[model samples]
Target chain A: MKLTIPGEELMGHGNLSCQGCGGSLAMRYALKALGRDTIAVIPACCWSIIDGPFPYSCLKIPVFHTAFETAASAASGVSAAMKIKGKKTTVLAWAGDGGTFDIGIQALSGAAERGDNIIYICYDNEAYMNTGIQRSSATPYGAWTTTTPAKKFKSAPKKNMVEIMVAHKIPYTATACIAYPEDFIKKIKKAKGFQGTKYIQVLAPCPTGWRYDPAKTIELSKMAVESGIYPLYEVENGIYKISRKAKNKTVKEYIKMQGRFSHLTGEVIDEMQKNVDKEWELLIRKEEFYGHTKE
Target chain B: MKKVVTGNYAASYGAKVSRAEVVAAYPITPQTQIVEKIASFVANNEMDAEYIKVESEHSAMAACVGASAAGCRAYTATSAQGLALMHEMLHWAANARLPVVMANVNRAMGPPWTVWTDQNDSLSQRDTGWLQFYCENSQEVFDTTIQAYKICEKIGLPGMLVLDAFILSHTSEPVEIYDQDRIDKFLPKYNPRYKLEPSETHAFGGLTTPEWYYELRYKIQSAMDEGLKEIESVGKDFGKMFGRKYGLIEKYRCDDIDTLLVMSGSTASTGKEVIDRLRDNGERIGLARMRVFRPFPKQEMRKLAEDVNKIIVIDRNISFGNEGIFFSELKSALYNENTDIPVYGFIAGLGGRDITMKDIEGMIKKADGKPKDIIWWGLK
Candidate 1:
């Protein structure tokens, strides 16, 4: 827990990420935490293309690019093989929101239930950014994606993936954001110490998908946490603790920053704020209740 | 020891002797018993392997692909819907060049849902880059399941052994189970040149641009082309070790014959029995059992087509639009061979319907040099 970033870089500079790509930063920070003795399991996501073309890799470590929905299961298989080979190497399953929240959830659930020793990281950027910003289950309410145009923006709330992983009774589960690399890398290091299934959901803000300025990537991520939208928390073996709690900021401040949410009316913003406050209260209650066990 | 075991048990014993390191499978009709036996072996400490309990057939193939990529031997079994469910991963396993061996019991695909024998389940996966073998009986099922692993590993591809559902999977036959030491000599331990090694980093199955994508596909086709030689060489080596021999196509009394009936899977046995009586009745008829369907046995087809004037092709599965899958393949294979000997195509035994000796004779009788091009045999 030195809170010091590793000097050695695993990801090479100049790859296939867009300007201020939060997913690229997440992988950079994650590789620094996990080190060289790791194999990345990348399903069909932006990273699959972003990892560069054939015979030219972006990461220094080995990468296994599997099908769209096989990251968790393939990582489980890789982890099992590593254990059999008597090598203590990390098998990291890095996927996007579409691969994780929707298609790959079943395989992830199975691996979690079986207690497969692999670190499954979902760099959620809300929509399917790699596929031209299609609507995903991780897209927030009232956001405009290609699948959900401005006329009919997303009517559903983003999926609660941390809670879903926590329900699997996994040994480690955490939610981090790309803007906070110190906390993000620390949580990844902490997850690496465990012996069972570990899941970390990193909020990767895609400027292209969210219709935001590329320079405001870090600002929007910071606002997402400050407005009580994507809270920074970790649940270790049924013991939940909120790492960073938000200040009292209106939901309008978060929505107004993104053009995807520009079409939302004031009445819909008020309704979203109410729902956000309710979810935060539920999180606080659970954290305080589980905090008793930490004592 | 010659033990009377079902085809599913034979497949289990084959995997056991070949020392499959990982078995991840799901339960489907006709294929459930195959996994049940493998699970029992692992539970009783008889097999040293990881028996992963999967929720679906997709996960079954995914888990196998993972283990195989990690440089370990993996095995799984499935039928109709389960095979269809694993369709995407089947291509993944083959395209990744992982030598994963699978036993696919040939159950009919359906909206009516029949759990009987037909080739639709495995034949539909013909272009998946997996080498396919059609088995006639429980003994062949046991023998070929073991052979599939050795052939695939040498060629660096995936293989599936196909046997008729219920007919071969449920029916018991006296099969001589090979000993571990003997099998060990025939098939050595699998140690790949590269693996999911953490110490040495290498990219696997990652993004390939259009510049290199076609070459990767060409390499797979080359492996399959080399697979023909491996299957035959290994089959001969297997024959040298044991007494039985298997070729790409098993020709039965086709020399100096005026007519020859061609079929695959267990139906070939019925065709053989009918041909035997036809020969006794002074008729020059023969049977050609198409064992390997993936590579198409083109060289064998050319030789067989030249020997006979009329070719009767019996297909248990239909392709729905034009002709039978095997029928179409055979006609194309023999198209440029300069023989216009009418390749009579007959469809029978779909959705678990039995293909009797009478049905085999009917197919031969329909091939009497007339305009009966494609016949749907024994349909009410």
Candidate 2:
């Protein structure tokens, strides 16, 4: 069965996000998948500014702009309150990487553990783009972010947030990308079909933060997946299925498009490449193991 | 029906009668009974509400903020550290203009942790844009808590119904209970003008640019001003229905008095005794009880101290560098009123230290007919 993306537009044009902002497009696609019968709980992030100021919201759906680190708990509350009203409102916890992987993890974990009937989507642009591109836990190893200057670049690997969510034993968890809108929208629609906690971490690129050209946002997202830097996959009830397989592009091809990684030496690049290959193999073994068991 | 219940139980009953749709709370001493009673109410199916037994005080308030924003009558209760821990969400609930009513069983802040009653816990949260009401008794606790829903819902601002820790929270008193059906007529179901509904999509608590941020906060302040104006009138209607009044300030025999001694919470009843005894002894003294702490109750403070020669405030909370918090607040309220009454700030209770009628009398005696600094009353 072919899943068609909804033609309905919940996000309006001329919003505040920087040009070619992948996080902005992720929201547009997310709203399309969920449609208008939704309430969005947004924490402080790039999307906070992207959703225009008060009295001039860009989203057509009702939005609840929350504190810096309360998207999940707020969505949990919104959904709980809606249940009492007997309204079928899809509450969306839309946040950025900083709000998700760092400050918001506590609230997110609490909500997930409780198995709240809400969908929490973190449109990760890697660094803290809203606060001037500081290095976040989601920032890749050897990448140059504002806080992690070229001297002592981000040496930590990108946090495996999908594994974290899967460990919560949630009903659904997935990784999506802007380059794969159909797959992204399909996974979101699938999440909506589930009753308990659903988390989708989308790899959205920031043109300004990632030091890439405005036109290369989709290209970067595509390369990130093709290089196994960010593979698209879904984990449902302990079963894993690779949504998009890597095309075997080197990490060099992926990093060449962005200036954030331009400062890396050949030795450092090899170290990063080794880590990525190891990560990809681990991911494949899990998919093979879980996928085999399911079959 | 009437029942002998603790003030905490009274708060739990109040939420039930209000038909609160969502309640999220964590347990702390004194305040534990309030949440436990609420949990039992939900467990027994006495209340048709979502009782989210959250992991912590922070999540408890966060859940309530979500519930309230989603257009439900939300309620919670806490004391001291729990209240302090819930501080961030408290600001969010108020700023979002979600009418989330909370009952804070006032307790002393910790160092050498104690569960005794004091005002510092709530007083420290003065500027969170939440309306505050201190109950003088368990009966008032029940009535005022219900009134708090009406108060917050009317103005679209959050409010707290405060009662003393063990003195009221743990101690039982006879409280008149009104059935849900009867209470429903007085306080109808919350009809939100705007909510988290796709039926009428709108952005709430959005990121306002500085160009518009000031006005949005100004609107909150304007709502506060409107709340102050509407409180007494709402109390009148509540009294007409329930035979109990919830005013900004509960004054006891303050008319035509020379020396006015002011206090809040359960201490009002004890202070009133001291006032009566002093009056019988031919001393012109009266007790002024602070009911609503936020919105400042400036008009009432000015009126209470209008004819008095001296005003002595016995605060259970301190402001660190400044005088007693209530003393500072009341003093500021009378600053522009042009009243030359020598207002004295007396720090009487801190860290669960017992405050009694004799201690209040000592505060009155220590007032040296001068606008002096805060005197640490009863300090050895």
lDDT of each: 0.89, 0.88
- The reply for model 2, stretches above 4 Å from the true place, is A1-3, A292-295
The TM-score between candidate 1 and the true structure equals: 0.97
lDDT winner: 1
Error of 1 at B240 (Å): 0.6
Candidate 2, B1-380: lDDT as tens digits: 99999999999999999999999888898899888998999999999998877777888888899899888999999999999988999999988898899999998888778888788889888899999998889999999878888888999999998999888888898999987777898889998888888877788877667988788789999999888877898898888887876678887888778888888888889899999899999898888899888888888888777788888888888888888988888888888984577988888777767887778777788887557868888888
TM-score of chain A of 2: 0.97
Candidate 1, residue B232: Cα displacement in angstroms equals: 0.8
lDDT of 1 by residue, B239-348 (tens): 99987788798999988897878889987888889989999999998888999998778877888888778888899888878878888898888878735777888989
User: Cα deviation in Å at residue B127, candidate 1?
Assistant: 0.8
Q: Candidate 1 regions off by >4 Å?
A: A1-3, A293-295
lDDT of 2 at B86: 86
